[model samples]
Target: MSAFSKALRTLSAMAIALAIGVAASFTPAHADPNATLDRIKSSGVLKVPVMVGEEPGYVKDPATGNWSGFYMDWANDIAGFLGVKVQPVETTWGNLAADFQANKIDIAFGLNPNPKRGLVVDYLSVPLFTDAWAIVTKKGYEKKTWAELNDPSVRIVVQKGGTMQVVAEAMTPKAQIIPVEDRPLGVMELQANRADVMILAIFDAVQVSKQIDGQIILPKPMLINPATIGVKREDGNEGYENWLTNWINYQRSLGLAQGKLHQTFEKAGIDLSMLPPEFSF
Candidate 1:
């Protein structure tokens, strides 16, 4: 071929390659339509809001005000996936629903799913962990069975607007249910002997008992609660939600979730034997 013809052919090949690159930029094979993930990536930070004081899951150390625990580890993995830094936002259990509604935070952990919450936020399709609600009380006030807590004399303290309150009511319809602002306060009431019982998750029951000298966790649990994280309900983020659900399952598959719980139990000086069989590491 003539030199001019050869040069024209080479120019044509270059144009085709440039066109393909442009097209890929607009519609790459892996392009995700999840606005949530897009936001996290662009911002370079995954904001994970959690209850401030819950131990073995989400704890803000009093000594240094640094955050640690199960959620912290999970947040790091999520941030790694997003290629961003994890920013921990402090929140209260009573305020999580409202905070999520206001878009004050992007993620919330250790929250159980319910209809009312479903309206405002979406839960991971796969549960991150399974836990049971237990009743804590003065050592002498321990109930022998779940039925014993149904008596009219039983006054159970629960965190206001928390799922434990709903469980407490369902388990002991005739008993009085008192709402407290947070878990720490609920345990404080029990410690003072002003409250006869306080209902919480098994881990929470253990955490609360640590605050008071003689509180006992009933041998039997009041209810089983499967736990998952929460993200705001945004329209066009279904792919992002599915990705997160899968990520959680991967964590469970690798024993990362269970391992975090085990680490927490060990740090708290609690034996894994006390946890249910399914919770065994």
Candidate 2:
């Protein structure tokens, strides 16, 4: 072949390679859409995370090694619907995403859907419940609005490394944010009078206030946050998420979720009247 003809052939080969690379770049990452559902059906168990020592949501009987709480009740309900047994996996909120990614658990409830965590797991659109940010305060420290509490002199105790901490930092930036490892430690801060305020979800605030004989205040212009379910972000997760959202909607419509919440609060010795008049499940 002539030199020009050979050069032309080479150019055609390069163009074809470039076109193939472009096509490959536009292709989506492969995922199994029905992977989670199929696994659950085959295994005959729905793996769910159950927090140890967490009341209202999860409680364990040391004597019988059995779990009972609103969360377990809901888990059992979901499993029953799927014709499977619920296998509880003890985990913490911070470790849930990791557990889901590692395939250690199949689903987690009561997760606050946030951007950072959304990258790792899929959250259902239907919320498990709506909870407002509230503060449990001593007798004379009631503040009507969040802005009123944003002062350097005001000391706020929040659960370390949780959403409460984030809210305290953002909403009460000028205030003192003391982060504790858990709820009990936060309660200790209040009881010892070391902290003037404790930030928590409204449901938690009511119970804690009753426990400590404090007062619950849902700051004005209430900050409403919804808790939802999180599942692993795997191929074929659409069906799983859809089914979960539908189930949640059905439960909410029938007042089953709210009924469970009421049962939990009552079992925890919390009076329904303690909740703010404006608050609803």
lDDT of each: 0.78, 0.85
Clashing pairs in 2: 32-235, 32-236, 33-235, 33-236
Cα lDDT for residue 100, candidate 1: 77
For model 2 the local lDDT of residue 35 reads 69
TM of each candidate vs. truth: 0.82, 0.85
Candidate 1 lDDT over residue span 78-167, tens digit each? 889889988877777767778878878788877886777788888887778877777777667657566888889888899988888787
lDDT of 2 by residue, 18-73 (tens): 99999999999776767678888889999988776366678889999889888789
Each prediction's RMSD over C-alphas, in Å, is 8.3, 4.4
Off by over 4 Å in 2: 1-30
Give stretches of model 1 more than 4 Å off. 1-32, 214-222, 276-281
